[model samples]
Target: MHYFSQSFNYDHSWARVVIGMWHKYPNPHCSHVVTVDVVDRTVDPRTGIIRTERILGCKQRAPIWIVKLFGGSEDAFVREISFVDPSTQTTTISSVNLSLSQFATCNEMIRYSPAPGGRTAFHQTAEIETRMNMWRSAADKLENWLALRFEQNAQLGKVGFTDVLRQLWEDAKDKPAHVSA
Candidate 1:
């Protein structure tokens, strides 16, 4: 098993950053995410919290050895669940890869919260583990590869989301205010 964690701050408010999360896909930097579908969603009227479940489709090339060993193509799928609480100004998202569950599992967690100076703090962690009863050498190699890929994708995600937030808020900031007749 391999573990990874990272934390940073975004130059945006918590609310704005959480709202930008939904628009992160289809970004150039994170092009591996091909499709996103909302499977379930609910809002708590009393607490003003929203929970959402989604499936994300991803396509990325795998190493030749991995392809031969795993017998899978470039397509993969992930199940993601998220919770947003306005009262606490926090958002949390968790995801797991579904395509390669029999061989291994990659679980990821991300959180966005209010930070000092009106910024949003971002934190992420992941665990990559190969199923038991596999050859130890092969399992270690697989875990290492997955960890490297996850780190790369995490960096890309940060860059992509930064672009999305800037575009979203900057464009809105530039627009003129509407006047009621």
Candidate 2:
């Protein structure tokens, strides 16, 4: 199992950040994300918290050997769940790949919190677990490769999100002051 975490600040309010998150895909930095669909969405009447479940289709640029080893496939599906609390100004999201979980599982969690100066603090945590056959040397190599790929993907994901955040900031400036989240 491998674990990693990172933190950063975005020059936008928590409300704007949370709104931007909903449209983060299809960015230039994350071209591998082919499609996104919202499976479910609901808002709690009592708590005013919003919950959403989404699925993302990803095309991985994996080595041919890796693709052949995994049934000549480069497509992966990811399931994501998010919770947004309006009153607390906090949002949490978790995502995991739904395919090929028997050999490995990678899970990522992100949190958006209100920060000083109208900034939004973003924190992300990623975990990868590999289940390999003890007698197979290829399994060990695959695990290492997966870990490295995950690290790279995380960085790209951050860049993609930042691009979306900047767009959101610009859009907010265009909106009327009477508008409310």
Q: Evaluated with lDDT, which candidate comes out highest?
A: 1
Clashing residue pairs in candidate 2 (N, C-alpha, C atoms within 3 angstroms): none
lDDT, candidate 1, residue 28?
Answer: 100
Q: Which stretches of candidate 2 lie over 4 Å from their true place?
A: 132-136, 174-181
**Global Cα RMSD, each model:** 3.0, 2.6
TM-scores across all candidates?
0.93, 0.89
lDDT by residue (tens digit), candidate 2, 1-181: 7788999998887887777887788878988899999999999999999999999998987887777776537788889999999888889999988876767778999999988998999999988876766336667666677778888888998889888878656756766422344
Instruction: Write one digit per residue (lDDT tens) for candidate 1, span 1-181.
Output: 8999999999988877887888888999999999999999999888988999999999999999999888899999999999999888889999999987898999999999999998999999999999998988988998899999999999999999999889778756544422122
lDDT of each: 0.90, 0.82
Candidate 1: 10-residue stretch with minimal lDDT = 172-181
What ranges in model 1 sit over 4 Å off? Answer: 173-181
